[model samples]
Target: MTEDLMLLQEKVTLLRSEGKYKETIEACQHLLEWGMAANDHKSVLVAHLHKIASYYCIGDIEEAFNNIGTYIELCSIYGDELDKLNLNNILFLLYEFNKDFNKAKATLEVSIALGKKLNKYIIISNGYSNYSHIYCAEENYEDALKMAKEGLDTAKLLEPASPILELRVKLNMAKAYIGLENFEASKSLIDEMINDPILDSFIREKSNCYDLQGNWYSKQTLYREAFESYTVAKNLVESYNDVYLLKAIQAERCKLCDLMNDVQLGYLVQKEYIAILNQISNRELELVALRLNIKHSITDIEKKANTDYLTGLFNRKYIEYTANQWLEQASITNDNIVCIAFDIDNFKSINDTYGHLFGDEVIQHVSKSFSKKFGEHDLVGRYGGDEFIIILKNISLSDGKIKAEQIEESFKSIEMMKNGLSISITASIGVSDNSGGSVVTFTDLFQKADVELYKAKLLGKNQISCGS
Candidate 1:
């Protein structure tokens, strides 16, 4: 079995080295399955790390997080410096791709410290390059330029004429110069990189530099030169389909065409702008109407989709969706996630005691109190009739229970109305924690909260019960 595993690893390495990423990933998965079955922790760790690299190569940031997290944990536990460094690199890329600049900078700091301590010049150079990118994203152009220059200097000291590192640093410096309105400096940097005889293989980097150059040209009202730069940028951006660069280049092209009195081209640009505008409008409509209804907000369409017409809280579906999102974010961030399920005690009896119209007023009053006490972050949805669900974030178990009690107390203070009548109400509450790895799915959290809610009902109404 050991010999067979070794052979499999070798083949996997060969495939990966040959750039057969798909086949390499397949073999890695098979290895992972076998490792899990055998309960071999080392193999499991290696398989996970390799999978993270494959995922990074393919630009799947979210999927990489879970595996990368596991790998980071295992490497820290086992004191593997090399694994730690590799995970840091993958994490840097993942966070950058996800637009989490703060986390990316934090990860790069740790990676750079380790690389410097270990005298890993290549890793150190990569760390500087990535850190410069974070500074660039944060719009700290001075810091970005300094870091990029440091990276280039380090790479040059470690190895002579490193073309890739030089290209990256030059492009970064161009971006910094552009941000500083040092257009001449920016153009100089771009021209040097473009004239570099060895940059032939860095097509993407060169294209991006051209896009930045075009942006500077457009800003300076150099239309013909800007047109050439934007044309190349448009071609490159189209090939990549990068939304950020595409939008920027298209906007520049539109302005230049307008400036040049190209009416036909301007109309074409206007058509494309209209298309993008319509796309955004539809997306906003979907988000505001459907998603808000399914989540927490009141919209015209969702008002129809998720309201009882008589009561203004929520329909049944909204409660389930909001509860699930709360649970998921809590699980990922390791923060306290809690849910409160409650109902107006003796609601049917209240209708019987007074009238159905009075009962409707009691429901509305309770929901209004719920919305008032809970912040926008908390989810409050009516779960049919007198029942309601509230999902809270970033609160501890004790704090969550306190919140439930407060909601109950606040409800008692509200004066409900029928037509010209006043009435009072009481509610039974349940609370549950969604805070640990042992919790399998979001449903478990909901079920646990529901169980406590049942306990509250059983123990007698107008009280609260908490899940253990």
Candidate 2:
């Protein structure tokens, strides 16, 4: 029975590798039944876990949970701390996707405790690393940093020469330092890692390290270097269809485009973006898998022509193009149009004090907050670093200010960076409505809003000063 189960497991693994989730799940079920009949708990548990993993792979949270619940029950029955760690980690992932930070934290704690009890150093280190990730999600950089270091130290003790461990620890630490505004330190660590001969031979580590390095450069406003790093990371990730790294690298590329002030070019890069997004999305179909790894070879030449990379917001060039078209229609219909300009207060200080990593978190948080606060018809874009512009269709100046205020308040609720340290953000806003006159050009409106934004900044950094 064990041998049969092993053979079944191998075949299922091949199917899954080929992206045949449906067939793999069916095979897994058969193996599971056989293992259960033979009272082979280990094989049974493995089958259950693999199926759960597959469910998660396709973004099926509910089904993933169903399988996980059974896996946990079986693990408890057999007293397998290792399996418990795996289950806990999966739960953490689910909670993370659900945005249930508190639950994720609890799950990670349980996983770590189990690891310690079982004397599994690797699991314990991994648990700590996972725990730190939760803090990262909440923008708690201080605690995240401490935990990352602790995990690295533990991992070091277990596998001193392990490039994988070294790179991961350094990467997380670099992120923490970035949030803390220690750019030099962050750069130094990244340089050392990249220069190391060991990283060259290890694909995953080399790829991830370069990604981190690219992010750091982007935060420092080093556009060309940032682009290079992102390019390298993307190349490495695409070679293996590594979904996690694929998204991460794509994000870095987005940031690079923002720093370069080249939104059109960035969009071109995003055309490949849609392709990759579709590939990951299709993981649900359970169709033939053609190696679902990220296409690392996607070059800047293949992205969309209308999207920005940083903050995942549309770029100014795209916004201008869109706004102009809308303006033409509104003028013909005698409809109202409004434009808003906003800036993060002391953005440079945020970068200087907390580091660019934290600075990035602030930008992303603000961008997402704005999206949630505004109407669907409203157009928003990252005008540049520390700046954003919005276009409102058929909205009043008062309403625009209200919307701006709501977005600013939402930003206040988010920590600028997640790890351990806590940081807050503030912005100044300027709004203009088309009600002022129908003869005004889009550029005129932009200038007026820019003036208002500057006045808001002059009044004081944290307050939103709005005007016509």
Candidate 3:
């Protein structure tokens, strides 16, 4: 039965990869039924994950959001570490699509932190690539460049890198360069992607590349070249049948037509846009039916999911949301937003030596101290296990570092006793802030804090590391 389920799930994945979202949704119905009958939590989670993505791909963002709440609850209750990580990753895309850039950045930050803990390099690379895409959408091209370069650098570290995903990252880089008005750099990258054989195999992505090529040409007022590029893109989408991409290409073409006052081009875009929108409307009706058929019979899973019930602190999701708000406010006010990460040193050893109950006690003990010392801050939360994160608003880096040191010193008294043996708990601390004056999101700041946390672990533990 397990083997059958795995094979069926693989089929669904392949179909989705091939852009057969309708088929993917159809397959998910069977998969979800089988998963529920077998009481397989993970399989049910994946079925919903794919179903939601299929809905989004087919231009039903509202349904995606509707289903996502249940999905997140399932993840919170039954998800493994990796399952929860993937949840954050998808939330990043959903938030991005909704134009909630602050929330998007926060989710990506959580995703990156989880990926690093699990050594999921692909997830980390994807997170950075997504950051670049978000910045590109915001027209903050320099930060987009920074993020894309980081993504590429991380991708290079993979033993056998994902070629197609790498190209997509490069595609984002090209768009960023164009937005920055670096025509020469943009053209060089675009030409490289256009010539890459791997891109030819993915018609939908190739169409996108051409659409971007059209934009590039239009940006420079090269109307003939732009028109030719848009023509190729339109034809490819005709074959690929991605209504969303088709509509977007038409929208771009419409702007180009208006720019040049080309009546023929304007008519062409109007015709294509209406045609694609109609196709989308028809497909959405069908998928909406499938959603009604296959949605899991679950309800009220979203109750207080933002709280870590074990310690009565805000959970990762809420922490990210709150910090993102502060980060946004700081961006406008030119104030600093700082974050600190704390990991209980030798926590596993304590779990092994003293009982699981003692370990729980230690966590509660430390969490209490956090509340007393730093509760009146921007955000405070538990990032699972024996780790906690605190966000300080409108604070300088130096001041934040001092607070971290003070917290570290305070932890000396936070410990539990077992049978006359008294052991004190010490933690490795990492502090990061927006003092660099370049970061536009919480993810940027969190990444630096995470790195500094690693540094503290490397520096013999029980020390404080602050990013410059």
* Estimated TM-score for each candidate: 0.53, 0.55, 0.55
Worst 10 residues of 2 by lDDT: 293-302
Per-candidate clashes, comma-separated: 0, 39, 0
Candidate 2 whole-model C-alpha lDDT, 0 to 1 = 0.75
Best by lDDT: 3
Q: TM-score-based ranking, best first? A: 3, 2, 1
RMSD each, Å: 14.4, 28.4, 18.8
lDDT of 1 by residue, 167-271 (tens): 777777788888888988888888887788775676677677778778778778888798889788777766645555566677778888989888998898777
TM-score of 3: 0.55
- After superposing candidate 3, which stretches have Cα over 4 Å from the reference? 1-40, 54-63, 288-468
Cα lDDT for residue 53, candidate 2: 71
- The TM-score that candidate 1 achieves is 0.53
